[model samples]
Target: MTSIISAVPACPQAPQAPQAPEVPQALLAVEGAGLTVPVVGGGVVEYANLDYAASAPCLSDVAEHVARVLPYSASVHRGAGFASQVCTSLYEGARRDVARFVGARDGDLVVFTRNTTDAVNLLARALPATAGGVVLVDLEHHANLLPWRGGGRRGTGDVRCVATQPTLEATLDALAAELRAAPVALLAVTGASNVTGETPPLARLARMAHDAGARFFVDAAQLAPHRPVDMAALGIDYLAFSGHKLYAPFGAGVLVGPADWLDSAAPYLAGGGAVREVSTTGVDWATGPARHEAGTPNLAGATAIAAACRVLTALPPGAWERHETVLRDRLLRGLGALDDVVIHRIWPDGGEPVGVVTFSLRRHDPALVSAFLSAEHGIGVRAGRFCAHPLLARLGAPGGALRASVGVGTTVAHIDRLLDALATYLRVGPGWGYAHRDGQWQPTPDDRRPPAWVEQYA
Candidate 1:
């Protein structure tokens, strides 16, 4: 494939172009790319992080952007110092950048939050009374499901959940029935499954919601990094995503939607910046984004997210999709070749997605297999319910499964490394001994250690 990452800079570089010599020139440069760790068998190997869905590594470009802005970093909004003014501009500009990245329409508000969970909660709290009840799909991540489902929360509309069907068409049909049966205000769903990487038909779902007189909301935390989230074109009324999942490892996320519900409803946070006037008896709340973004905002995190957006948005057309699709296909095909390896997916008709693959080994312990991958092969993957317990139960894997997710920084080499490691583990079994401890399997007498700096903090 043509190199979409590590592209030559538009501006000529200084005398000797600055680059991390050890980091591989892959789809994108990420933190800890070239770090080598000692394996259980007395050999060192480059650490392969296949856990991007959990929290992606920071992009090198975003890190540089953050370093350049650090000198000017200061408290944002209404601060009188020069650094504060600069930071304010950077923070607000970051909001605009995120809005554009998601194809926000006019009158849309971009409210920054701690992460996707905070963004979802803020939206749930800001839902207007007239918007009717919320209709959620059973496939949502806990971030999206927990907020609206909470009891006695102000502005959390009457919540109802619809279980997914065997197929995408049937699932949409069921959602439509639920919406038509009730005076539903919103149809909340995940743009893609974090566990299976199966993307629901978002455009069709959006249309179904509108036809039933309900608005559409997507948990785009998984979709934004791999695919474009054109909210306007997709007819999404509200969307939430996290920067950490987008290669910006910053504690920031955003809610992009119309300002009407947010403006009319109670402020998400009742603190200093959210209010216009503070009286002993009653307080006046501000409007627009400020109405919700209370407390000292994450200016640095917002700036980093904006830097990540800029980097991702500048990619050539179709480059991002092509890169992930090719690599994921390679992984799927390799895993398919393995006997008794059950790859779990929500829909057989699942759409193109980010590179997330969840699988189970029938004769092996999933946690043990994952621990072996890390300790013996220097590969990092997630093994658990993946915070989507409902989906896990529905998939018949209540015991949890192994998840290997790729990112913009992931490469064919990384994909092959994981496949090879799994094959080795399954064929020969984990050569090292592991014991279940602290609710997880650990290699017994593990000799691998973190870099010295990690010890310094301890």
Candidate 2:
């Protein structure tokens, strides 16, 4: 008997849109291949992780890379088995990958540290005693600022912090004057601002520092994740950045560039990886990355970081910028249209920035605003001083302002939710009997409709 099987229906697939199905994870994330983490709320809130200037979630691809290598976790370099040999190869390979990722010298040292904080601290301590003077920016994050400050405290050098200006022209002029004033040995600067998302004129600053007989050190913790950072092209003598901020979030970082300061100065930490010999009379140190690393390095973290970099570099650079620009412009336009809200240096002009934006509303404490958004709207945002105490102080932000940072994961819907919640708060006043406490304004229950004066953003 000729039996015919019933025809099976094709599995339903989402209809393709004209432009990649509208990129549900937002433009940046979609372009960067970054993934979003789900919240407990009903609507899937794409993680508007503008705090990428601080830290970013590990890319899904990097996580996969880490998983694939998990089964072969063996001691590297101190090989005893096949697994050890494989682990060592991967570790060294990761170094080469990271070096290329940042456009470092072919043979440059790539030391793996815990994070940017550790990397900067390593460089700070590793500077030779002869390097008696260092210039740093006042707007630097504590990770960058405190290291030099601590170095001065340890009597290593006289750390001079150059005061910053709100405008770039004024900043460059002041920096030039400062560099000309003395025999500067090192100039430490942020490639981009974590608060205002402003990036200084890197190539110009590099030339100025070099001309003034100083080595330029770039704290690229915020810049690397967004754009291409070529150490040689920028003429940067030393560069530091964290894996966490670069979509790896793997307990590791990179300290790349000149080897002289790292080679001659006393090791930052001393233990297994840094030494070649140890005795009562003397201790012989290993050369290159191992010298600074000293202790057991996080091999997995380094490999994962390399994996994340590979994923990021695969995308078209222009696409990354274009996607973020759309989101940034949307944020600026929306925030600007709102009544009583002031957007700081709103997009395109004030300085070359990334997707991060900061703003404040009239009579609203930033802390309360941030807390309310989290509690009621399921919008996760950051508020208060964003670690750079001096910068905030300079901005006259006595209590700080609410910061909404966008990353690869941020979507237009996220911005809309933020705008909606703010409007609701302004119109209805506080809800659920929220009251100000100890100098903070508290929210009180009121009619759902907010005050009439509150305006809607286009």
Candidate 3:
């Protein structure tokens, strides 16, 4: 059998370098890049944050951007003060920045929400009554799945979960078959699996959905931060992503899409700003994005997202992709060399994955391994079903699995440290005892304390 290492290309084409006006230095520096963590032996090691799939640390530039706007923070939409006017302009300008960043089509509306879940729920509420059904695959995050299943106004559309095939082409074909067989009004799919980081054939799936008279939606919580997304170019009717996962941890998310369904549907939240007029007997509703974005929005969150988007756009064309690929390959090859390691994947041929890698050792509990890595090796990773229980069950790890995800801040040393920690655990058992508590494996007699700054702030 050919080794996976041999199958990888020796020399892939380098990504195009950025032209003049390089990325901001602040954007390049991630907060908590050199954080220190205490090990079990009373020694501290530099923390390796490899759980980027969940939530990434804030980018320095995003933080700076927020600081710059903090002084002028005021009520948006309807205020008489000068601060309010500036704040409103900044908020609206952020909407424009995000629209352009995602390549939104002309007239497309961008609605600000709390997070991707909120954005998807908003879309669910906006589903028109004429829509027939919603089609998605089993390999979706809960955010993408539950909204279509139990959410939506009128609760009219029937939900169908298509099984993912062993190959990307086969999975797309199955989705096409389902779309052809039913009157699918919407097809919601993940841009990339948060668990395995497997990227589906998004463009093909969008084409298929549109050809079958269904609108396509992408849960880009994972994809948007890793790669560029063009709504018009990919034929995506809608897209939802969170700033927390995009190096802007400001509790903001976006839903960028067409206006017809949203404008026709009732406002997501009824409040002072979302209404046109109100009387004792009746009320008139506002149209456009204002119809949905009801109260005072997260002005800072929106600004942070826009700032991060600008930083990403300024980066060399393929620099992020190339950098991540090298790290991913290194991690995969290192894990492959371990005889006791087992890498879990969806496709049989081991299709290309993003920065996330999920696997388990032959004789170790996933949670225990995760705890050991953190407590002894100062490595942070996610260990659980990763919110995609169906996919994990299908992958034969019904209990759970461990996932190590990378991002712009991840370094080759971090990946190596994780691999070395796992190898050490396999060769020699954990140095400390671990027990499952509150559904998570925690070290016994844990004595970890907050950093000095945290204590002072608290």
Give the winner by TM-score: 1
The residue pairs in collision within model 1 are none
Worst 10 residues of 2 by lDDT: 1-10
223-305 per-residue lDDT for model 3 (tens digits): 99888889999899999999999999999999999999999888999887889999998879998888988888899999999
lDDT of candidate 1 over 49-111, digit per residue (tens): 889999999999999899999998788997999999999999999988999999999989999
The runs of at least 3 residues in candidate 3 whose Cα sits more than 4 Å from the true structure, single-residue gaps closed, are: 1-27, 349-352, 452-458
Ranked by lDDT, the better of candidates 1 and 2 is 1
lDDT of candidate model 1 versus the reference: 0.84
- How far does residue 417 in candidate 2 sit from its true spot (Å)? 1.7
lDDT to native, each model: 0.84, 0.72, 0.84
List the candidates ranked by lDDT, beginning with the highest. 3, 1, 2
As a TM-score, model 2 comes out at: 0.84
Candidate 3: RMSD to truth: 7.4
The full ranking of all candidates by TM-score, starting with the best, is 1, 3, 2
Q: Candidate 2: deviation at residue 185, Å? A: 0.9
Where does model 1 exceed 4 Å of error? 1-25, 155-157
Residue 62 local lDDT, model 2: 80
lDDT value for model 2: 0.72
